[model samples]
Target: MRLFEDNIHIEIPGRSTPSARSPEAEPSLDGKVNSVSRREAVEAFLRLRLFMPERQKRIVATCMNGEERQYFFDKMVEIAATVEGMPVTYQQDGNGDETIAHLHYFLGDCHWYITEKDREGEVEQAFGYAILHGDLINAEYGYIPITELVDTGVGAELDFHFKPTPMAQIKQALEDRYG
Candidate 1:
């Protein structure tokens, strides 16, 4: 079955039935797909889940069974662990200096500019400036759990085009644009 399309397109094999046709094919980066297991297909779907819109998510959810949903979360945790967190030095420096935000997460007017992360902790926590619904007065640097951003229903998205930028510069830009 054809999942969805974006930068990369994935087509997982459908079940065996007389009515079932061959999976609609989409070449990956390498342009080859000899075979794909159900687990692998689910993994690919979860990896791209963050970037997908709410409508697409609902559609995908309907296609997935309870087992697949559980697998998706388990795989997500594994994937999260592999992601490189903020450096120890950055955490130690605190928010005193003009720290660089290495990651940007956004959904509509809300934005999370991640500066530091506690990699050693059981639950991944990011220290960053958050501006929710353009509330500049309330926006402040604080701990934001990575899990919150990855929640399937939340629809939060990581800005793939964002580059590391100074918090001061970001603040200045926000002020110039919003003020």
Candidate 2:
């Protein structure tokens, strides 16, 4: 099995692991995010997070040792929490979930997502929530030096998506080519 296929889990300080949640329960910070499905939230988060300037750079730093990986990972977790808390600050639904959210993150690249049927031939997303689909990665995050998911053109593509370009690598590529 692939390391990421169904094993995608991000650690939030207060939230349970995605692997631990029920098939219907999507992991949220304070309580259950029943309004927006887990898959949608995570995908929305991913769609925005990967495009950050700092985050884009972190993708390149993946070559670092284990300790460094932990450091960057922690930073990302922090970003996710900050974003999640944004909408909830105003008001909450009867379900204690927020309906309106402002995704201040992915405004840079105009990199939104278009979901096709997932590998299982099913897919969905929510405007209130977002997730980081390392699986849906097709473009490089602005400075991150990681290879992204390529469109297989066989099974359905993830409806939620983001565009990433390794800012660091692009700079390096330019330097190597010119200098």
Candidate 3:
């Protein structure tokens, strides 16, 4: 097992904790219960209600503390519901794949995710571009804390794919609840 740090991959030989999903569902190519499958990734995102507007949610499941995971998911949903609604243009870099971004209203945090694939078209690595950490502050509405996500490459920028007709209602609900 290994923990990949900021742009650096480190290897460690040891037993890893079990995944949140079932082992029957997350099998590896070599018949090992090792890496998270794409299906598991999507399931994790959906279960957490995380949103990635530009790219499809194809991230691997990662182990994170409850606070960090909540921060990331909370930000993801808020961004999808508010600022960037569906039918929005998907922004891609020169390689023709989309680059995703999201805004967190809690502390006005925004993040940009850039995913790079390998020669076999499998996800090789992912990096965050506009990774901003929000500071805890008092706003006109209420308390706002700086937000942060787990450092693992498990997070994705969920897109707002629903109809715009119901967006206004959703945004109002968020403002009302979070305020």
Give one digit per residue, the lDDT tens place, for model 3 in 1-179: 22244544334355333344344343343545444434443444554342332123333234222212333343334443343232222222342223332232111343333222112222222222333442112222211111123222443333333222332343344446555
Off by over 4 Å in 2: 1-66, 88-179
Residue 71, model 3: lDDT of: 32
Q: Which residue pairs collide in model 3, if any?
A: 51-158, 52-157, 52-158, 52-159, 53-157, 53-158, 53-159, 134-146
Lowest summed lDDT over 10 consecutive residues: which window, candidate 3?
Answer: 139-148
Note the Cα lDDT for every prediction shown. 0.60, 0.33, 0.32
Q: Which candidate would rank higher by lDDT, 1 or 3?
A: 1
Across 1-179, the per-residue lDDT of candidate 1 in tens digits comes to: 43433425335565333124223232333656324444664665665464344655565555444323333333333434333444532564755537888777888899988776655533356778899998888899888876666574766776645677888899988888777
How large is the C-alpha RMSD of every model relative to the true structure? 8.7, 16.5, 15.1
- Candidate whose lDDT is highest: 1
**lDDT at 49 for candidate 3?**
40
Model 1 weakest lDDT span, ten residues long: 18-27
lDDT of 1 at 81: 34
Clashes of 3: 8
- Candidate 2 local lDDT, 39-88, one digit each (tens): 44345446444324444334424422222233233344444444444322
User: Which whole-number lDDT from 0 to 100 does residue 71 have in model 2?
Assistant: 28
